[model samples]
Target chain A: MKTTDNASASLAEQSNDEYSVRITGFWSGRSELIVPALVFILAGFLTYGTATMKVMGTSVPGPQFFPTIVCVLLFLMAIIHTIQILRTRRFPHEDSEGQNADFSTDLLSDLADTENEAIYVPTARPSVTGKRKAYSDWKTLGMVAGAVAAFILALPVLGWILSAAGLFWVVCRALGSKRPLFDLSVAILFSSAIQLAFNAGLGLNLPSGFLEGLI
Target chain B: MESLSLLMEGFSQALTPMNLLWVVIGAVLGTAVGVLPGLGSAMAVALLLPITFSLEPTAAFIMFAGVYFGGLFGDSTSGILLNTPGNSSAIASTFEGHRMALDGRAAKALATAAMGAFIGGLIATTVVVFFAPVLVKMATAFGPAEYFALAVFAFLAISSVVSDSVVKGLMSLGLGLVLALVGVDGPSGTARYTLGMPELFDGMSIVVITVGLLALGEVLHIASRIHRDETAVRVESKGRPRLDLSDIRRAMPAWLRGTAFGVPFGVIPAGGSEVPTFMAYGLEKKLAARNGDTDFGTTGSIRGVAAPEAAANATAGTAMGALLALGLPTSATAAIMLAAFQQYGMQPGPLLFERSGPMVWTLLASLFIGLVILLVLNMQFAVLWAKLLLIPRHYLYAGITVLSVLGVYAISSSIVDLWILLGVGLLGFMMRRYKFPLAPVLIAVILGPLAETELRRALTVSQGDLSILIDSPVTIVLYGLLAITLVITGIQHLRHSKTARSQALKFDTDKLGV
Candidate 1:
């Protein structure tokens, strides 16, 4: 029972870190300080915007009333968040969980061990010599975002089906699908099916673009 | 009695074969979307809002009602099998539902969740049927000041109470309100932050914001990590799916208790299903201790799953009542539904029933129908949904990406909206990556406009008297609740920090072999 409890606890931890970007150095946790800083900058911008808004009436609340209030609130909250982040250990690396030094352990192993009691028993790895941060797969995130951008750029010229098919392939490749042939087939079939349903069946006009005359 | 007769008439209208088919379609679609991680009823409703524009209000709302309940039902399936509860409401179920799956009682756990949801949802809908009129009557008495105060109360409650860090939550709330302020002010006719765009004249599209933040953001988040690990498998259980007599006996009272936790929260703008679910789980845990049952927090507890599932569905049901009766949206899903009501060019306050009586009653009746359909579908096909977890993560997320793009593009048929979707999706990704809560942002966006309008109207009525905000009894009561909430949260925070300190000390001692 203790083992199960600990294993489940670790599973919760794993899930929490599922999409987190890893960092190194003694200031690893300090990366969290960036969000509060960004929020503070945004609050300043809102404040400036509110201050410049022309008030139409003298008696009633102006258009800037709510925005100004929210801006001030955000400014104060961001400051408080900064203070809190500074006071506490800000990074996952600083956590006392036994595996902080070894960032190369396969995530799938952690998942497979979710069902096993052995996960509760932490294995000690030698403290690493250099700063080895296993940041979340940013390359895939970039590729996916790029794919969406490409779709946006392509849609007006290439139309819905073609752009959407291209999007599907790009996303599939980013998600680590190994078979390009299968990916192409799936993307074509899926986009065409959507075209048939929404465009043909629902009578909604999807942008035909260059395919306006083609099948 | 009048309500009962009206409800019966509503049943007559809704029970037609055509509406039944709509309900079936909605339930199936809602369940399919809801089973996917990171997509809840809010996203489902938002993505489908364009359809509402083309359909009759009654049929559109019936479909939405099905989606609402079906989302809650389907969320627990993924929570049980995949350990990924998409929404806060499903978090409590993960506590013991996943444990039960690991304990080889997956079928029993699923049954408990399904039946509990049905009982709680049915009872809560009955509450709505009886109490909506009363709520409508009460809502009629609310002045602008009272409305403003209620919005403030909601904003404060969600920002300070829902999340671990009050600062982060308030930041999220602030950002949402800022987003809400982007369009031309409805009263003043001045553009606040349109950045010289005609599309910005109408403000950000809620559907675009919602689909981008939730659906696309989630897809991006998952894509970032999908290649690092293989997809996890669903836990297999040995027993038949049917709940035994003993199981039902244990779950029945807990279901009622969970409903008790949920009903009052429905009235309050305390955000979403998360609070009631945690409350139910805690209550059941204490009850288990009282009953000398030590199985909780370890292997599994049936009441653990039953109570939270009931609480979640009960909250979903009563939230609809509040939305329909008072025009208050307490959760993200309800907020989207509120947006839907707005899309129909109707405000859902005291005058809604009077202005659209038939539509409102039919919607209520369809909710009941949706509930029954959800129960049947969930019970019979839950195992089939567990199979959904077996789909490769890449394909699942790739499909979501397509859906997000399609939904956004379909709504406005504009590339500009797609651009907004991508930008907001990235913002959502960053927010999630930073552990900032998303619900506060959503709630603020939905409620911010109302808050501003009501405040301005109140001040205008009083000719700039600040005391007008406190003049009414309703406003006073709401402010009082806000104060009490703050005090309680402060105490809780203090207690939590103390416990954490002690735990840290114990850890230090253990490290030193003390």
Candidate 2:
């Protein structure tokens, strides 16, 4: 209650953060396990590459020595991380008690050096272990990913202004923007301003594909 | 007297109409980004790195200095108004700053922060004018072995101190080292991990890493979880941000003490101002408790805001000193500055003072100039800056995503780069979601090459004798400092872990530390 008394809007999460973080099944999604799994694969690849590295160095510590050390350490850390994940059975946002400890579920927790781990004073006992759950939001996320892909593929052909504007529209849509017409107008205006700033201001040449020579 | 005269010569250049404009623009832009929850000066500079490619080196650096200091000045705004710190460094300020706002002292909190930042940055920059040359002399004396030792020291200290989990920090370090190793090996001319992509012959650019990880990755992460997270609650902080005489009296000593806590960390390789700001806050809280002057957690306390704000800017100013003198960036923002230096065919080490002495001086002098400009702008317009948070999150992130891609493409004009940007953005999203410390990745990518090159060069010189690394006194001292840092961090970790395990599903109400 004392912790709840002093907490901000974000502190509301800890008390009622009943988000279902059911990352289940071997073939399904254990999103928390993905990072470690990827590192494991990367380590294996690096190990193979190190053994077969070309140009055997004439020096004492050659080109492959450092990679070998890095790969080995990567493997060791990945194993420990995997074991830790499996043993705790905790989601990314959960503490060791398997309770949601992610402050302010917004993604700001990422680069922010918050003591989300085994640190910090426990604020208050969450009176309610609520049943709300957060999902991956793959549909919207996939749309955003698709938008970036489309922009990358179409940049040279569609030009900076058009491709950038299109990317902006799709990303806005992905982020749950419903006003397509207004979004498109804002996208066009924004991209064009960037174009003007870079071209007329910075003197860098951004391609003008369909809008070529149109100012 | 010579340093004083050189500083004056720098002032002469910084006073120019053009450079002065850069300072104002950079300070304003830096403050804008710093006020946003998801943006920081590091990403702003990284996005601008490519655009600054064509500008004169001096003007670009002047703007960079402005942006760097400006971010620190503005970081406490949102913290005071919304209780949502724009970044971790401002979290310390938010504790009491927000309390002050709730107590109807929002103006006082903002004013305390602005003035504290101004004084801290000014004092630290002045110290740099005198202190950096000694550092430069030491950097000048560094041999290959000593350079390698320093890099190792930086790598170990940052990885250990920055992350709570030692394994995660090292893994992040490993990932960065792998990225740094992607291009051709300088000595052997054999590529490490390019995967036959011609665009990667030069390895990855710092612009891509910083922009992708800090800027675009954030956009993607937020988009993925847009609905799950609660929307930030903003309170309208009205009134002019003017501190009273009594407020100033209480804050003045705290400001100096916080700056003292910050300057040493400026030279240390531990990334970010988090540790220093938190320490400043902790010290102020302890002192306040001892004196019974003010209630810390319940009511508002100006000392809390003043100390952390001053510490944040103090660290930023001295970080600049570390960047210019030692060519060793002490924070992520400084790391990007170091990258900007390399992009301009200039390496920021001892040689920089001799080769581009004027530019370094101008950058340092403009820090002072930037602080003056930021104090005026922030004190008068704290409310206006808070309004920036009202921009819709979707549009804000959308703008960031598009601008980041465009900025990266502008640099090299390669389709491959855009693809890599997306890849790195995804990587950044994952890292952010999983609590991976992003500083080690940036620092390692920047320092990994130097470490490898120097290690090999030292080994080559010694005819395969590894003892050459330990033969030098400088290397010995550097490693000794690293050892001490590890021990201190380890003890801190153990103490924190014990407290963490003591609690089940609740926070430790009596204890303080976040």
Candidate 3:
């Protein structure tokens, strides 16, 4: 037990060092402001552009007016915050020597080094040398995205039951469920119970799709 | 005497078999969800909201109260056993609790936490029973402008104080306000941000946003980390947990201290249990240190577990008072309960106290009863709850996601609603990832219309006299409290930054082998 504990502790220590290096490499002070700012800008522009359209009737204000104001505010705030972050140049906690690593210069130097050091490209899998994988687990992301897409596409035609079951199965499988039959049954039971509870028990009119008459 | 008589009448109503059954069911379900990591009372209530449409107002509220109290009990179980807090309030409990578990005193820790919860909950409920009438009298005197100011206070206090960064918190609030701006303009009937979608005329349902953001968003976040090799270590207990006379004596002081810390914070508009729990823990730690009980970190200090647990439960009761009396929810769970009240067309405010005095009194009475129920239940079932950790994460989160999607669709039968859920889910994910607080966004959306309508109505009534806002003593006090809270929070932030810098320097010195 002691030996195993020691081995696990060493492994964890090594992984912690790797994680810290990676996090410090990517998560610069400016990146925090830059990423959120870009997202807000994109979302703000979309909201503003959509709000600009005309809608009939009630003359209180156009549909776009409030959203436009919000978008403009968001854009202005993001820009101001980003500029403030840039002016600070470095986080408060960094060592003076570390602060001298200009962010843009570091990025450019790293890219150039990578280009020079290019060799036999590694496959996107666990290495035979037993090194840990460097890339994200894309399969899990795909599974979640697929489940969402299936629900959106199937909800209209296949209705709640089929679409819900499909989404649940996809997600469960992604999470490492191997018992397809048992998991599927569990999903169906849950979905049916919810549907009945809302429709019959609560007097809600949930969609029945093609099975509307049969139910 | 009149209030007592009214409460007796309320007990007569609440004691009915149907209401009793609903409360029990709600409590059981609430505890179950609360015990599950990442599943909270807010998500539970939000999921059950569609089903509440058919129930009577009194019964629905009874069930909601049961769920709220049950969550308080349930969250502590996770904190004590796994060190993964089911709620933010339980985070402080984990510091001492996980230490106790490591010391092979898990059962003792669990027992003390349960006892402390009962004591705190009982005291808080009694305070509510006695003090709610006075609060109602004060709350009733406020006009539209005062209410509007109160709403602004709630928004700013929650956004700035609850989150790690004020900017991100304000950004989340701005996002929520933008979402609330959708649908028709109430004053002029003009479409705002609906984008020609007739289905959005009623605006996005709070239910959809809540379920998508909290339940579905959590499912996604959990999935992202599922394949990670790291898992929590489980401790095996040698025997059943029992409380000795010494344990009881040690815990009693901490319970009282925690209650003192919790009740006032709960009454405030911030509506979070974290502050009270931390304050209680800090106080206990200081007292223990002064008494030369620095060994509390090694040997399980009953005070360490008791204080945070008591604060967690005590805050639950005070939060209810804030909700029922002020119609303002300080937490996500409270927000969902507010939605449930609205669903039954029963607004919770000063009028509620006047019109439903008996009901409110009985509800307060049931809290005392609920505390007893939770204590009995937790003591008997601590082991059973610990076993829940063995359940596969995949099955649990997947099931929650499926239920959320179905619940949203069932509410309105609109595909547009599903789209809104997806959109909100993405927004919630981003907010969580970026450390932006989600509670303020929900509060802003829930109260946005009320603020706007009240502001407009007050202006018309005052004939554009802005001084009408501060015309009443009540409004003046409310604004005064808001100003003090802002100043205090700013000072606290400055202190925190200074402490963090010193701590960082200490770490650097240690790293240099000095």
Candidate 4:
């Protein structure tokens, strides 16, 4: 809402003055473009450095080939873009300047305001009762991360079913399923279905987990 | 007669009970997933990919094609009825279809949209069937340089034309190329970007990248805005959509014109459908305005519904052609479908046409059948589909997140994939938030290795003579097409700017209270 108010105020100012210095059009005063451009340069440098290192018979095209190509393209595009922005900034009358005058101003202001709001928006405080809730939404992220970690840690020793079911249960809980019994049942059923379809139906040699001997 | 015989054989293969079952299942599942807001075709295909691992390649692709077409049709239903487009392609339909829905003519709008889609789809498929063989014959002669050039063309076309800014689009593509560079270098058999991590030696799975980025990323995005009061409500249909003589007469020209606008743009690498649909809509509006149809917006002009709907489906069909022939996916959905093709150890290129001609023909044959199925399904069960809007957003998205995690895990029993999924999901969320188009990223990732391998091989073959790129007629023609596409798009942008200027002038005049 603050962003909306800011955008509206900017629009009002733009409309009020006909000869004001207007920062307008695409790529107008946005810093996010710098991130990708810098990333390209860094990636290119790393790729070039790696490629220079030789290993055995195949030196891997000196790493600089592919990365350099990508980097150069990105750099050229960025340069062309920066030039266009500057050119537009300098020459305001060669084209339909008056027409874009309002539209671009509105767009820039809206974008700037929205970005400001995103940066400045304060986090909501949880109520006293909300703090003690059994299943926190953030716990879902933790559970998923835990499930994946558990799968990796236990897959060799505990096998597929144990790890898969653990994953399934964690994911289901993350999704707000509260019934432990139902969650376990669903997980077992899903694992069995997968085992049957992949191992039995298609003859894929999937890890049978602890159920390796039974069936 | 020879082509007719091949067609008959294709129908025989396509009409089998087993294939029919797959088609129906695919359509049903595709539509269901597509109707769910934020679950696009790419996610649907990626999630179902694990299931396809157990099926025959033919049956797997049969179902994939069914899902692809069905998703397109299904997305339009939500776009029209709920004013929530499931994919960016359906955004234009929301403009007029929602207006018609507000006017209590939802049924008519739905009917017109379905019919227009059917016509556009059928025409495009027919074009594909005839044009594919010739294109394949030409593509067979292409060496690595030509192939690399073609990939460049695709990258240039999609990045420049699809996104609002060419810079952001190219940046998204650079990100994809970087992601693709991870894991072992295929040509030289050395680690590239693995960064001392053994798990990354095999590289990140496309399944993980796609599911994490598209599905899980979408869920996180929705969750970030959970407090927002945006929810889809089911709109009750007043009655069955009727095609009155007058309405049909009015919509017919728009349908034809829409197809004209759509078919060409679809063949181009621009993944976005906004251009053609908007072009059709603007043209129709201008023509109607000239005829003194001042009530165009208020009365819900038939052209409004017809042009965008036809253009949307036409673009969908031609996009498939580009994918099947060039192995370049212009959109996320096409990129996922490309992954599906790769899953079967099949590369969709000139060889696919030569070796799997029957399957290709049959797939094209099924598209015709699928259109009829879509028409019948959309016209009769539209209200039923509109009910999908009532499903709680939290539950739907939560379920999808669960499925996405499961899907990536299912592909490889490795926990590392899950970690990759989470990482890619974060990346996807960032890209979306930053307005970087995701399609180019997918295309670049999928095609990067291929481009590298081919470029190396071509250089080896030609002994490093770069002029070999333009030596062939096919490559020449392709370059010509790319040049023409760039010029045309540039002109179109200029024209669009001019139109915007006129509109602005008109707005200023009105603001002066003249």
Could you say which candidate leads in TM-score? 2
What is the C-alpha lDDT profile of model 4 across A1-215, one tens digit per residue? 01132333344465532212223334433334555556657566656646663443443343446766776666666676555444332212211210111012222223222212221111232222211232113455555555556666666676656666676776666555668787788677766676566667766555666667877
Q: DockQ scores for all the models shown?
A: 0.27, 0.29, 0.15, 0.11
Ranking by TM-score: 2, 1, 3, 4
Worst window of 10 by summed lDDT in candidate 3 chain B? B505-514
lDDT score, candidate 4, position B263: 83
Indicate the docking level reached by candidate 3.
incorrect
TM-score of 3: 0.85
Choose the strongest candidate by lDDT: 2
Error of 4 at A22 (Å): 20
Worst 10 residues of 4 chain B by lDDT: B223-232
Which whole-number lDDT from 0 to 100 does residue B372 have in model 3? 75
Q: Residues A25-55, candidate 3, lDDT per residue (tens digit)?
A: 3234344574456657656654765656455
lDDT of 1 by residue, B1-514 (tens): 9999999999999999989988888898788777776677888888788745667888888898899888888888877876666455676777789888888888888888888888888989999999999999999999999889988887877777756557777888888898899888888788777777898889988888888887898787777656544444567654446887988998898899999988888878777677777778878878887888877868889998999889888888899999988898888789889988987889998899999998899989998999889888888888887776677767778887988898888877888899999998988877766667677788888888999999999988888889999997888888998898789777766765676567645543332234
- By summed lDDT, the worst window of 10 consecutive residues in model 2 chain B runs over B504-513
lDDT of 2: 0.80
List TM-scores for all candidates, in order. Answer: 0.89, 0.91, 0.85, 0.79
Q: Give model 4's TM-score versus the native structure.
A: 0.79
Please list the residue runs of candidate 3 whose C-alpha ends up more than 4 Å from where it truly belongs after superposition: A1-35, A38-73, A84-138, A196-208, A211-215, B462-472, B491-514
- Fnat scores for every prediction: 0.43, 0.38, 0.22, 0.07
The residue-by-residue lDDT of candidate 3 on B90-132, one tens digit each, is: 7667667877887888888888888888888888877777677
lDDT of 2 by residue, B1-514 (tens): 7899999999999999999999999999999998997688999999888888888989999998888988887778988888767776787888889889988889889999999999888888888999999999878888899989978887777776556577778888888888888888888888777778778879998899889888888887777778555565667787999987888998999999989988888988877577788778878878887998765767878898988889888988888888899888888788888989988889888999999998888888898899999999999999899888888888988999898998899988888988889999889877777777688888889888888988888988998888999998988988888888688767766776566445511332221123
DockQ of 3: 0.15
